[model samples]
Target: MVANQNSVVVVMIPLPLQGHLNQLLHLSRIISAHNVPVHFVCTTAHGRQVRLRLQGWNPNAVSTIFFHDLPIPPFACPPPNPNSTNKFPSHLQPLCEAATHLRDPVTSLLRKLSPTTKRLVIIHDSLMSTVVQDFISLPNAESYTFHSVSAFSTALYTSKKVGEQIRELIESKGVTEYDLSFDGCFTSDFKEFMSVQHEYAKLSSGRIYNTCRVIERPILELLETDARSRNKLLWALGPFNPLELKRKDDGPIQRCLNWLDKQASNSVIFVSFGTTTSFSLEQITEIAIGLEKSDQKFVWVVREADKGDVFNGNIIHVELPKGFEERVKDQGFVLREWAPQLDILVHPAVCGFMSHCGWNSCVESMSMGVPIAAWPMHSDQPNNAFLVTNILKIGILVKDWCRREEVVMSAAVENAVRTLMGTNEGEEMRERAVSLGQEIRKYVLGNGVTQTEVGSFIAHITR
Candidate 1:
């Protein structure tokens, strides 16, 4: 039998989707840079995507970073229902089943590695944690539960008491079965849930947030309390290697830097609904008018249509306002179908993000210290938007929610975009963002998995 001979730590990253993969790749690079031998555990299909995207260079100086593909059936999450946004389709019901099936693949892979002494870091999706039934049972290993979102996001996952009360009264169609909406979900009924979550956080050995100190001050405070009680590490590490990002430069990168050069520094408003989360045509019209009215120089990423049916009113995430692109072409005040997000966000000309609040985008934007115009689409997005608005105090929300759906009228968009674009408050918010960005950079490059902080973190788990 081939025994596991390598000594450097191995992190099994189960990256199911785009966001999940990016977060893991970022951390894997960080660890590999510090002399740790790292392997990104990708499914065969995903591994193919990685190879295509990454031109292939070593992640760090010494260690060789490679993709380890585990042959597993593609997970059966429901395709985004082309029919409507009003409800989640039944296709998604299989996610629970897929997550369950994944457990064995991960376990089998762990057992296949014969190095009994080597430590493991499973930098996978938070959703994958559901099937990670046992961690201590594995060979020398520690887990770090890294959220692609900010710490502020975790807090907002629970609605301020008021929203919960409203939900109780309203009794919406889907309200009965699910947990609380951003509107609210607080109850003594959650004792067991909280207990289990806290347990996992402790068992994790370390809890990492892809965020900065300024916006996440409160969430980290709460996390520290929880970690200290459980004696775990709480690391706020973010903006991890945007400029020097590599090991995957082969992907088609949007030439967004040239666009930024022509725009005024801190004057452009960047909008994107993430790789997923297409908007309805109605929603796009409203937003376009808003950008026009606000007189903001902006760039919004849209997606091409898939299937004949309208995913969201025939508009993909890449679609833009009709004729507006032509009108604002000179001012650079239009949108792109897709742009290199991190490259654009870090650019001096880019100022604020008008986002759907996907966890990855949220953290990346926050870490850049650019304020956000939160436009939550679904699931944890509303939760993320809440954090961007209330906890971070860096975001000025666009009053776009209507009957629980985004009602982004042009006027509303104008107000929110312009407010975030520039003003005394906006300037202060930008500075606060920059300050927070600095703190995040400090932790990421300061001492990642190699140092005493993360080393102690690994030690706690190995024992």
Candidate 2:
């Protein structure tokens, strides 16, 4: 597990959010499986969080991967506002600001590793490019930008003449302009932050996406045009988080899995939003009512919104409608703890997902052949939802992006659940999803396009 002085090593730097951290950690496992030494660098608290919440693989046992938990100055970690008109999780801006302080520690780590290793290869989340900006000065060090979002979403930001190009792309696929909207996704400050990250990516040695040609051939082709036109490097070696085993412990996640055993095939809908989302109490009540009225079996995973620091030892509380759990005891399961999403999605009883369309969730659902009711919150989610519902036709939009500010009433929620779970149209989408999932799984195996891409990346880095 220990690297020798002459070994080539990879250092991973991820944005401190759950989705970002999860992707990079999964990437670390992939790279390490190939006999490469990987140093995963992050804030101390976030490093602990990533390890504790990691599913598939045990971080402590991964000797080839090292955790460099650097300290960052404290900053405000405000809870997200679901009622805010702005769809973005702008509340996490303070964490973004604090991440800048990692510049010094990161730079020092690079310098220390430079003389000892044959080469220091840095794979960083595109947004964290600023923290590793100084890597250019080291002759033996090269950095690649890892995009956690899908290639489809990345193209919207990277393509030149963005509006015209995207219009043509969408229209070519038979999508209506009104089908996709980003009316209030990002505020000016957040836009500036993203612009800086996209610009910083230009300075990296290559671009790496958690995508494969099977899922986003056209989008990947578009990115290649840009990367090749500029003579920049690019690779699509993904469908990360590949494992699917359920946890063995008798925890809430396992209990949820056990409950799925008794349900009929394709009879349950699994509803969960990613970690960054926080709904207002009223909205939470509406969701409870909606699920109850839908008259379908369901498993809803609910958690308290993050308050700046999830590690601050404060008791987390998320209130539901009074007696809601008791009322739905026979018909539904309300899981208040962390649920193993892949395990749940792969279950025979679970047929559909009501999700925020975060790219991670998008990939997982499609990979498991589970259809989605897309209710995107912000960021690349709206665009990702558009991809699922409009282009691929593997999912349904639960709510349009323009209506994000309004509280989606229980009636609307009930309708979406019914449409995705109880209708023949939903069955057709599920059939398509199953076919697509089979293709994805195929490509990630021997001699497949995704595995080939992974091989190419390893050969490039280790050669």
Candidate 3:
């Protein structure tokens, strides 16, 4: 079934998020390396960001990856009345508008390519499933859905029993264990968004997950066995991360690297949530206090949040405990802007990660052999935290979604930090993490599982 490689094109449409874009970009790189052409569809704003980021990439290698910008549509939702309990609409409005507006332009792009292209395969974000129907309607165009979350998270969402279990967990107060039919493990406005994504998944030709077989075998196997999901082809083709890209040592990256050089091996905890996560002023103060109380060497990345943003509408000015900076001046560094996350994880000084447990961060930390202090924020992060702490045993939970509405006390944060960085159990977890990291590296290199799956996908699209 080997078709002419030069005649085929992969149309990659990622959701307008940093994590999703990063995974798809890396996947496109792998496909392009096989000499296959890639047409990456993104919004103008995201396209500009991508183009700027690629300035550091190998020009000749990425030459085949073309960008197609679908302008974000102007759509507005009425502001929440002062008394309305719903906050999800304001957070979701932008993405909803983007999804609805991008479909027509994406369809037009596919239509133009169909006449000359031998085969057109559209790989879209799972959330952007609305576009799949449009592409599949076009002549010679095939559509596949890609999830940026773990296989475990995917399985939980797709499985009826697991979904029910999660519902019960959400309803019951003080419920700690997520006892499911299998052993794996949101709001109404968030619920509606997920519902649309679930419906869209059913219409796709197949699905691709950014997780590996070895890491999530049980959940993946469950997905394979489920009657509802059994018919769809599931490809586990990841730790799809940009491991090879070297970070330029200038500004914050240089400062962080220099700071790391002074610390003892595996002594510092690297703290950061992914791009979209934001914290309340109370939460920030608590975290700062916790870190100070832990008395550990650390590097924490903090970002200012817009108060108007519905999802994470925290105050912009984060006031730490008075004299907090002076107290821990020798022991910590708080980065106000972006820090080189991947570079920091691989440093010898970083022993643990305080993370939101986003899939990208989770995979990156695991791949780098750095253990995590799981503090899940939203979306699939709660499930990811469960996987890291309970299933993978590579991390400990600092906070769970069940208590997301409540502010985490500094004592709780301090306890989690100490347990992750100082305790005997933490040592065991670190050892396991190092071993898993090595295994993941071997699995993604030449002729490994990830490569084989990517090859298989290329064959599927070409044939």
TM-score of each: 0.76, 0.95, 0.87
| Models, CA RMSD each | 7.1, 2.1, 5.0
lDDT winner: 2
lDDT of each: 0.59, 0.84, 0.74
TM-score of 2: 0.95
Off by over 4 Å in 2: 1-7, 161-163, 179-181, 449-451
Cα deviation of 202 in candidate 2 (Å)?
A: 1.8
Q: Write the per-residue lDDT of candidate 1 for residues 1-463, one digit (tens) a residue.
A: 1275445356555534556566767666656655566767766655554444332234434355766776655454434553355422234334323434656776766665535445566654455554444656876666777766556545445224434433443344233533334442222333333344444544566666665454555456666776676676677655443534332232334345666777777888887876555456677778777777787787766663222111224443445556777887765544344445777787788889888777878778766778888876555676677656654567876753344443567888888887787578887777777776666655555664235445554444344
| Model 3 lDDT on a 0 to 1 scale | 0.74
Per-residue lDDT of 246-266 in model 2, one digit per residue for the tens?
556566676787788888999
Who is ahead in TM-score, 2 or 3? 2
Off by over 4 Å in 3: 1-5, 50-61, 75-92, 161-176, 179-185, 227-230, 305-317
Where does model 1 exceed 4 Å of error? 1-8, 50-63, 74-99, 134-136, 155-206, 212-215, 228-233, 239-254, 304-322, 333-338, 400-403, 442-463
- Could you tell me the TM-score of candidate 3? 0.87
